[model samples]
Target: MPHDWKEIQAGDEEVFKKVFDSYYQPLCLYANKILNDIDLAQDLVSECFINFWEKRTSIEIRTSFKNYLLLSVRNISLMHLRKSGEKLGNSQFVIQELEYVEDYVNELEEEKQIVRVHQAINKLPEQRRKILQLAVYNNLSYKEIATFLGISVNTVKTQMGRAYRFLKEELKDDQLTLFLLFGSNFE
Candidate 1:
């Protein structure tokens, strides 16, 4: 154990600091992999550590300290994603993400997949891209997007369909977008 759970539970600041120093960077990196946002990732990891310390006395750890901390960071990051999604719109992305994202994290840890996913999304046509963004990012409905873009609901749906098809083709080699593109009943 990198940390003395009993000593830390006894309220030793030095031991807590040591554990913090040992795991902070790696935990942040793990969170970044989960969130794709470095700033949010860092913030979440810091809070996870703080919570660990605050709950030390009552928390039971049957696993290694490192595993416990990693699990904590993962759960905290995913919870943040879910909550932020709810606040923003609670749309399809969040629902699909909750279902598929953990699979991606476990299967692919390389940074290249993130880059590839971004690039493929960027390659979409302007109108199609905008529709996709409004639907997924802004969490707008087909009717809402049609009104916002001054188009018919059918047109909005068509454009969004094309956008998803393009993204599916462009990202055929990567499953990272499975969360982003699927669950729309597009397939």
Candidate 2:
């Protein structure tokens, strides 16, 4: 009910506290769905609010304040996942637009597939695991990972290829297909 963002923009601490109290728990819960770690989710949501307060004067909210806060938390959660080397397979971290009731079921199924793929990635050899994590989780390009790890671009590419091949062999057919289809784009 506290929608007077004007006061918040004007450095009213009480109004900002009210807004935070209203949205913080719900935002944390929503972030937890994607992050799967309540502690990390709470931390990310806290960071989102901190950034929101810092940017209040310059930021414009075109939608409901709740929506803006939720979107902010979602983006921050995804950034945390990227930094932590976690990849949510298929859909590429997009918030899906559900067209039917069955889409919800499909979404759950996809989440399971993503978890399986992540497990398979964890089982990869150490070098390939690191390379694939950089590519998939960190969103690093081959050249960037090469530079970061002090390896050649060709080495990065070659390791990534072997990583995928190993993953294909390790996972079952359906899961491997899902990984192949939704996994990061390879060169």
Candidate 3:
């Protein structure tokens, strides 16, 4: 509905109104995915737009205007989450909107866990890493990996055991380490 944001910059109330009308509902829905309360989502999105209007003359959006508005909503939602003191990593507190699962999965904490797991796996001896990747990521059986790698099944078994032990030691404190690491949805 918004024809041009530059019109708003030129002091066009009609343009601003059209933009607000077009974006408000969808932005509220997006915020609700993070906050899980439609009323609160509406309030936050309204507040964000109010602030946007107040600063309309001065705000310098580095990205597209739409992205700036969405980022504002996202930051405000995360601030609400932190203010509520939710245990963010707890499965119960994670985002429940199936469509927004990728948003949660790409969270900074989860990303860091993924990076740490990758680093640990990379540090593994090459053969063990390859075997572990075959067994876990590629879903190959020990016999299959042995045949493919031209190694004995017993060797595959031993290497897999060693790899598991190493990973367990590395990820001992991260309860969802494996789930985060091997989850196909995350990839």
Candidate 4:
């Protein structure tokens, strides 16, 4: 056993490798129970390990390694689910619903719908695109975006309104337009 948790705390790669190798699969399995998507579960587990290593110096472990790893996985998975607007439930049922949704999108019309939506967004002015990206991708509030860009809250709201109008006009298809509107709002 690597007795010097201090060395691990200092970001020794070997210790991290040992810990990662030991915990990765079990953590993924644990996270999958909450996230229901295998890829997302794996991603959450990886993020948890990276976070653990990053904050290792201040980490105090009173529990066994398995318990600590599981707790970390659970927390990360829950965060991901919350962000994605999913609620935790039976893992199998959640996974089935996810797969069905993915398959539904894989149908022919959905591909064109996605492309049209992206094209409409691409057609937006650079400033509007930046504002939308900040608000949607980074989950920033209107006030935060205004502060970051040195603009007023009203300006941010106006830009978002303009962006939505452009998207609504460009994406004539109802599905695509609905997606652009709903997907733009993180909360």
Off by over 4 Å in 3: 1-3, 89-187
Q: Tens-digit lDDT track for model 1 on 1-187?
A: 3337788999999988977886687677767767888999899999998888889899998876766877788778878878888343334554454335444443444455566766777888888878888988788999999999999999998888888778778876554445654564546
lDDT of 4 by residue, 69-120 (tens): 6667766776777788876666666455434433443443356566677787
Clashes per candidate, residues 3 or more apart or on different chains: 0, 0, 0, 0
User: Candidate 4 — which residues are off by over 4 angstroms?
Assistant: 1-4, 90-187
* Candidate 4 residue-wise lDDT at 53: 83
Higher-ranked by lDDT: 1 or 3: 3
Score every model by TM-score.
0.45, 0.48, 0.46, 0.44
Best by the TM-score measure: 2
Better of 2 and 3 by lDDT: 3
Pairwise TM-score winner, candidates 2 and 4: 2
Range of the 10 consecutive residues with the lowest summed lDDT in candidate 2: 97-106
Query: Which of 2 and 4 is ahead in lDDT?
Result: 2
How far is 14's C-alpha from truth in model 1 (Å)? Answer: 0.4
The alpha-carbon lDDT assigned to residue 142 of candidate 2 equals 92
User: Which candidate gets the maximum lDDT versus the true structure?
Assistant: 3
**lDDT for each of the candidates?**
0.74, 0.74, 0.77, 0.71
Could you give the C-alpha RMSD of every candidate to the true structure, in order shown?
Answer: 17.4, 20.3, 15.3, 18.6
